[model samples]
Target: MTKNFNDLVADLSEIEGGYAGHVPPEWLQGRTAYGGLSAGLALAAAQKAMPDLPPLRSAQVAFVGPIAGDIRIAVDPIRRGRTASFIGSDISFEKDGEWPMGLRTTFVCMGERESSIDHVSHDYPDVPPPDIGKATSRGQALSFLQHFEFADIKGNPNQGPADYLRWIRVAERDGLDPMVELMLIGDALPPAAMKLVEGFGPISSITWIANVLTTTPETDDGWWLLRSRSDYARHGASSQVMSVWNTRGEQVLTGMQGVALFL
Candidate 1:
């Protein structure tokens, strides 16, 4: 039987080693793999290599090629230290009996470091909750959004813009692993939000980076705020910056993405 969207996402949570591989079904797109799936799998592989370290605080990934067909990924440990650990992994798709499509990622774990100075300089827009009433799932009918609820704060479905605010919370049980939750949320913001902005035309992200500021978000059962904006777009490319906040309003993650927008 085919795996449902939630089932696939749940399976991603448990992927380790090369076992994270998936067979593309007829309904799924064959030209390019979803960035979220690749990112989640890479993060999972990284976490497996550094099981003893603190939960994943952040990850950055670069998509070098299209992962359309069958592929394999190998994870390599770059650095393992007392205070932090770094891991690297790559995905390659099979092409002409050889693997192609390259994707690289770095995972970092921040150990117990305390700082008395607490200062934050970012501010979120005071937008009302996105009309949960108008959220739509795009790309390969079985999108990750089907597993959760999404609300759009800006950009109408009819018109395209570059900025968007979304409220997301898993409908499943509370207390999910921090790294897994981060992987899920981190991958959700990039593509669709970038498409909404007009200047960034038909661009695709070549790389994505996310940094986590708090570790407790995994155990909290609350809404997370994803405020995303495109700062600039030029030469058929653009960059987006996003801030993630827990329901209590504490910033948890910050991310930026560079996209290849086609006009």
Candidate 2:
């Protein structure tokens, strides 16, 4: 069945032990579901497990195996403290009954805590607005790309400093929970390894670590600025840094991903 971004997130429902959901093939990168979908669902399950929990402080996800078809997600609380709670989540494809993907995150509901320092030293990059660029067309190249839109802001990656900037958003309007939004957009960028080569190639993310600065920011127009750069790529492995900024140029989430470059 065809499902939009909201539909996809809506399908995730809290069950007795955890959550249950399905991702349509339209969002599949290959035989496996899109990395963001799996991660987002896991985070959603985490949210359900701790509905009154605090905002996400840090989250690490390891893609143990392909998560596709129907699936069951279970969340476990590692530890709960007054100010912070650590959570662990796991997902298993229902068809096979073998759990693979796993996520661990720390949430903090900082109330009126006294802090000696508060500062943001980083600055947002200057880039053209999303409307000024053309919508990226993967052209049935990958069924997954159809659900979202992209505007390429930089040219060939191999010819430059191996940095990529783009504007991305879902085609359909969907109200996503805060944690769910962070997980989905954090993995939206095409692997930075693609810039290390002459053209497109196969790449799979083995591990992803996202540090959410705050509750997911509300998107005024649903557009997010995706900026990514690869720090190193060697021996069939690449490490890249990525960030998702809202339309107002605020850094909502930052992450690092380790990918297996098949090229």
Question: What is the lDDT for 45 in model 1?
Answer: 60
Candidate 1's C-alpha lDDT? 0.63
Candidate number of the best lDDT: 2
lDDT of 2 by residue, 156-210 (tens): 3343466778777766646677567667767877787786679777778888888
**Stretches of candidate 1 above 4 Å error?**
1-20, 23-30, 126-140, 154-161, 170-176, 190-201, 218-222
Residue 3 accuracy (lDDT) in model 2: 77
Alpha-carbon lDDT of model 2? 0.72
lDDT of 2 at 235: 94
Q: Candidate 1 on 112-216: residue-level lDDT in tens?
A: 478898788656554444444465323333544444556655544432365666777655425445666666666565554455555443446688888888766
- TM-scores of all models? 0.77, 0.86
Kindly report which residue pairs in candidate 2 clash with one another.
Answer: none
